[model samples]
Target: MTDVLLGIDQNVDRAVTQAETMLDLFDATDLDANLLHDFVDNPEGASVKQVDSVKRARDILEDAGAAVTLREGSGDPAQSILDMAEQLDVDLICIAGRKRSPAGKALFGSVSQSVILNAERPVLTCGSPGDEA
Candidate 1:
């Protein structure tokens, strides 16, 4: 089956728009990534919100009828995202965020930018629900 990697982070709260898009765009195995801990740990209580975010996003995706496997990544967010994509050798990658102007992109380097620049596979970027083209 085709494999698709979805790179998610704290911005995941805004990923619904992109996730839904992917649902219609591809018929593939979906892999989700959350670089919550540099080292694996039990995600409980209130210590790690990132883990919680991943779980919530995973639930959302699953509820939407997309079967997603959450992958745990370590180290830099950008590197981890690429590493997971490479390791899984996914056919495509999907990430979501608000559209940024050129100046905004230059002011802050984004994970999506880094992945789009470096990943050998195709990358699908999704913007906010009401974002203009």
Candidate 2:
């Protein structure tokens, strides 16, 4: 049983793409995926199930026969993902990487980069559909 923590953002395309990539990369029957959505600004107290990206990802993974669980987090997105990964003891942490300029990243910070740098376990990043190399 391989456990995976799939960090889903608001990008529906990226989330679905990552889910499809996972199905192609692993045996769905042997995979257990936790779909996580972090509400960075949760004044309204949003739930993970309320996020379209997480819900779509869950549907794709579950349809492929992967055991799927929904998780919610509030705070820094990268930190939340790392904390959940540690708590779940997942074998892999998967996230979507969006292309950002160096200056943009310097100012805004990159969640994928932070998770990759700080994670104790392996982190797999899937680029968005039209991202260039």
Using lDDT as the measure, the top candidate is 2
Candidate 1 local lDDT, 36-76, one digit each (tens): 22222335533334455566666666776566776666556
Q: Please, what are the lDDT tens digits per residue for candidate 2 over residues 41-104?
A: 9898778888889889999999889999999988899999999999999999999999888988
What TM-score would every model get versus the actual structure?
Answer: 0.69, 0.96
**Clash pairs (backbone) in predicted model 1:** none
Which candidate has the top score in TM-score?
A: 2
Candidate 2 structure lDDT: 0.92
Q: lDDT for every model?
A: 0.63, 0.92
